[model samples]
Target: MIELTDNAATELKSIIDKEEKKDHALRIFVAGMGCSGIQYGLALDDDVKEEDVTVESKDIKIVMDSDIVGGLTEAKIDFIDTPQGKGFVIDNPKAASECGSGCQGCQ
Candidate 1:
């Protein structure tokens, strides 16, 4: 299952509250495919497709396409605020290993 770190859940909740998106669910999707297997993206979405898989973690509802769920199983989503940068990151061991260290996306 896709899991969100505590920090990510907090930050996501804050953003949802700030944006007045109480009715929306966090949507994760396959944004693209490169040498790094698949790139995922997140967004607040109110639309839920018939083929979507929905789950609740840390009180946050997350939706993703059924076909992509297997690749993201056991993935963890975290928010980092280091000096270099700050953003949400999905740590998927399977995807990382598949991508290896050669591609720029993997690096």
Candidate 2:
């Protein structure tokens, strides 16, 4: 299950409220491989595919593809505000020692 911290939920809701797309759900999926093994993508989407898993958080619907569920099962989403900027951060324990695609040194 993916968990969103209070700050993440509020921040995401603010962004979603400003989008032009209405009646759409937030789609969070695994994108290309990252330095940590897997990268995630977030978008405003309305299409719920047959293999998608829908999770509700802070009254918002977050959808993810079924195939990525295992890797992101206990992931946590949080918002961070640093001196440089503010953004969303996904803390995925499963990716602690992950290696991205095309990396030959990681196992």
Candidate 3:
């Protein structure tokens, strides 16, 4: 199952509150393919299609397409605040394992 870290949930809640998107759910989807395998993107979406799977974690609703749910199994969403920047990050072990030493996108 996909999970969201405490930091992620807190940050997301803040954004949702600021944006006044109380009805919107966080949508995760395959954004593209990289050397590390599939890359994911997150957005606030109010639309839920028939093929979508929705779950609640840390009081946040997460929505994903059924097709990509399997690939996201055991994945964790985190928020990082480093000197470089701060943003949401998805840690998917399956995708990381698919990465080779030559991966440039992950670097």
Candidate 4:
């Protein structure tokens, strides 16, 4: 239920391969209360509870817990390394206003 870019998948795989302990999947979801309104979060988790929905993106498995603040379907996750630093950039179409990078959900 999600689309992941090549760069994003690669970046995510590298991270998972590093931190994952028991074949855990990378969990990505959006939560309220950010500088704009929503912010993206990423974490390496090993527990996939019953309510979690798992989606395959290339070689990476992303677990989505519907009970979370919201869903991340049809979202592209990218890891960009700038001269300053690096972070996960999310492009979400569900957002309402322009928050980052001239997109609806850029934060």
Q: Count clashing residue pairs per candidate.
A: 0, 0, 0, 0
Better of 2 and 4 by lDDT: 2
> What is the C-alpha local distance difference test score of each model?
0.91, 0.82, 0.93, 0.71
Which candidate ranks first by TM-score, i.e. highest?
A: 3
Model 2, 1-107: lDDT tens digits are: 88889999888788877885557887887777656677898878989999999998777788888988888888888899999998888898988575655777555
For candidate 4, which ten residues in a row score worst on lDDT? Answer: 98-107
Instruction: Give lDDT: candidate 2, residue 3.
Output: 87
Q: Look at candidate 1 and tell me the lDDT of residue 49.
A: 94
**Poorly placed runs, candidate 1 (over 4 Å):** 96-107
The TM-score ranking, best first, is 3, 1, 2, 4
| Model 1 lDDT tens row, 1-107 | 98999999999999999999999999999888777678899999999999999998999999999999999898999999999999999999878545555678646
TM-score per candidate = 0.88, 0.83, 0.90, 0.75
Off by over 4 Å in 4: 20-22, 68-71, 98-107
Please list all clashing residue pairs in model 2, or write none if there are none: none
Tens digit of lDDT per residue, candidate 3, span 1-107?
99999999999999999999999999998898788778899999999999999999999999999999998888999999999999999998877666676777766
56 Cα displacement, candidate 2 (Å): 0.9
User: In model 2, how many backbone clashes occur?
Assistant: 0
